[model samples]
Target chain A: MSQHAQDYTPSEREEHQAMHLLPVRRADLPFLISLALIAAVYIVLIVGILAAKVFYVELPLIGEVFTNPGYRYAVMLSLISCSVTTILSLWIAVPAAYLMTRVRFPGKRLVDAILDIPIVLPPLVIGLGLLMLFQTPPGAWIQQYVRFTYAIPGLILAQFMVSCAFATRSMMASFAEINPRQEQVAVTLGCSRSQAFWMVVLPEARRGMIPAATIAWARAMGEFGPVLVFAGTTRMRTEVMPTTIFLELQVGNLGMATAVAVVMLITSLVILVLMRVAGRGMRMM
Target chain B: MIEFQDVSIQLGSFALEHVQLHIPTGTYAVLMGRTGCGKTTLLEAACGLRPLQAGRIALMGRDVTDLPPGQRGVGLVPQDGALFTTMTVADHLGFALRVRKRPRKEILARVEELADWLGIRYLLPRKPHGLSGGERQRVAIGRAMAGHPDVLCLDEPFSALDEETHADMIALLRRVQRDTSVTVLHITHNRNEAQALGDHVHVLKDGVLERQDPKLWKK
Candidate 1:
């Protein structure tokens, strides 16, 4: 400041700098204004909701809901059925994915198109179709061997039909990313077809498979329409978490419904985080 | 000895017809061809990777045309080095040995020996992605050699290497061939490589084998 004061007065120095350095033009003003507007809107919508204390609704007493033996049984049945659905979907989907990706057979494209039908069809329609099939004469004759209509088996079947397609689609993409030539090389080297697949292809595709499984599990856990129609939303029999939320909301128990929704949100968030981590590890591999 | 007697195949638009070739035991032969001339298909036919529509492939006087690649006793190093991405260099070299139920110690020793021979001993612990093109080719060759196959088919093994490295590789392969006495069918589009490495060169153009001029290729 002493050196500058000695050289020139503040006004003279400002004039000198202005003469050398050009002022910013107004050409970029529109872009900056648009960016600022977008940022403001985002902050008001996203940050405002997250920051608002009104959105934070507290849970009511759990004692009343837990005391009801029917709720407890419903929860237990949901956990068991969802777990079974996840396991069965994985077991069936893995092989289906592998075969669909690796093998060449007659009507391969037809089988692929058929597998896709479950994913695109409305779950309610799927449930209705299942209902008609299991209740009708030809389907009823088959049902004698295995109970399906309005039973636990029907719920599991509906869930499986809805979720297996999702699992297969994800796993198929994962399997496709892996080069089949790797498996061919392994087989030529000495491993049998199965051995080569298990050792070489599976390990490489494991990361993709994990997320597929997780997605399937998450979808199965949250499934409602099919389970309701196929298994019937019985109080202590086939009532899963979503069914519980629906039943509670119908009876005008807002607090309990919100609680179930919160639980579902937490579960979904945890699964999504796990999937992200798995996907990242897969990329590193 | 490996022999192809009037072998022919048609894959979509590409075709290889009436191809007859022979490789005497312990001699290194090169298949010289331009692109789209069905050189790779010939190799595939010889290795049992592709089915032959006509004619037969005989390995050590046994008809192996219908046999699978594993049962053909022929090792193939594909053009891209095709090393298993999930396995380490040592694991790849020892793959066939492990599949054949060889002892772990023996497999390790052979892998180390081949790795050292190829000047890639230090790279044994690394994965294929960590290797240079030359190093990958070395590992592919080592893996093929590890199987102790009757014949080795190298499909443009040095094509990906730089000129200097390619020269070095040619010398290395010659030494390896002299030592092992393993019959090799080296496929390449480069005329210099064919002349340098081949004891006999079969020139292929548009899937047809041209008459060879023995005097054109010198030692």
Candidate 2:
């Protein structure tokens, strides 16, 4: 007879203690070791790159990069732009994802495909497209009032375009994982649809928003080809931290470039860690 | 009274055709069916969670077929309680009153009353994660009753409990239905449970509902 877990009696359960205590099989070694070796290569590569950057640049160059007005301004601008982009992305992503997950509407697949265009399009292509769009009549009309081509606003727009797709994807998965029955129960208990969303669904999705924001912030920080193509590398004008690396390299300042790169790397690492810790705390609660 | 008059529902490939059921006021109704037999789907239709393809549902003699789940004046305890993972037990108990913007004192009084009645007063400050399965169901029942709803729909409320816990829950549900005098439609697959608690027992088969005598279930 086939034995199920719940069907085990007291004597059978005692016998099953041996099943739980069984030693690791020798046949699993090759599979386990191969997977570990492949994983170790990626970890070592990341550690090696960080070590090379630290060693290639002098410590004082890192300090000088921080103290330099142009570089400092670039850092501030990058931070501000990334924060703003993350906020705006979340503002659109949360509602869009909730609707996409819960509500059935006409042209949903078409809308979904259009939203994924940014994620699939090459970074340079997005910048080129944005530039071309400005040249169009309607785009030109909007540009007349607000300059987006080769401006700071272009930097945010570029980041938001790419990052929002990722945020929306994360949020959609988050909402999908939550059981809709809770919201149904809430509605049956006198809450309207909007009230159930705000009270029940949103609270349960708090953990998901963390990863979405972190991914968006990281994407914004690392963005290069789009910002470089759309927004020019004008020092103290539209230059962000990523562009700082390009600009420093252009002037034969390799150490300064590596230092700026290191700063970006460390900033991203710190924020990722902080966000993960916050997510963990939320899960515990 | 709660009534499902010639209801027909289609969900993807699964369909419940011409389902009919009635439970008089202040009675405990038990719905029994095998797994995947559309018992929950039928319950959802009555609660306005699912739209019927044909026919209508009436609650307390009111035609509530087109009414939204909230406006239908029903409280649902979905499978495994479906308790809000983020809120405290007290928050769950006070949720309906709070949403209606009832007085803070009134909400607190109702919360206390339900908590004490459900014997979950000590669990008031804790969220659902730490709650035992039986305790969670009690809290769910308390929350459902907090709104003083005209009807309570319980979906497989005791399927997860041990024998002892299940017996306790049966007694508790009986007491709750008797004291509150609210109409209840409880779904379960266990025949013994139907015999233990039901005033009117039903069985679903081949997408049709049939009223059955619980005492004659053994035959």
Candidate 1 lDDT, tens digit per residue, A7-96? 222245588678998555699788878889989997898666544422554545344445668666666676677778877888888899
Expressed as tens digits, the lDDT of each residue in A135-254 for candidate 2 is 999999998899997898988998888999999999998888777888899899888899999999999888789999999999998888889888878989889998989888889988
Model 2: fraction of native contacts = 0.65
Worst 10 residues of 2 chain A by lDDT: A1-10
| Per-residue accuracy of model 2 over B35-98 as CA lDDT, tens digit each | 9889889889988988899998999999999999988889899877888878999999999999
RMSD of each: 11.6, 5.1
Candidate 1's displacement at residue A77, Å, is 4.7
- Compose the digit string of candidate 1's lDDT tens values, residues B180-199: 88889889988888878888
For model 2, state the Cα shift of residue B206 in Å.
0.9
Badly placed stretches (over 4 Å) of model 1 are A1-56, A61-80, A136-146, A278-285, B211-219
Docking class of 1: incorrect
Worst 10 residues of 2 chain B by lDDT: B210-219
Q: Which candidate's DockQ is highest?
A: 2
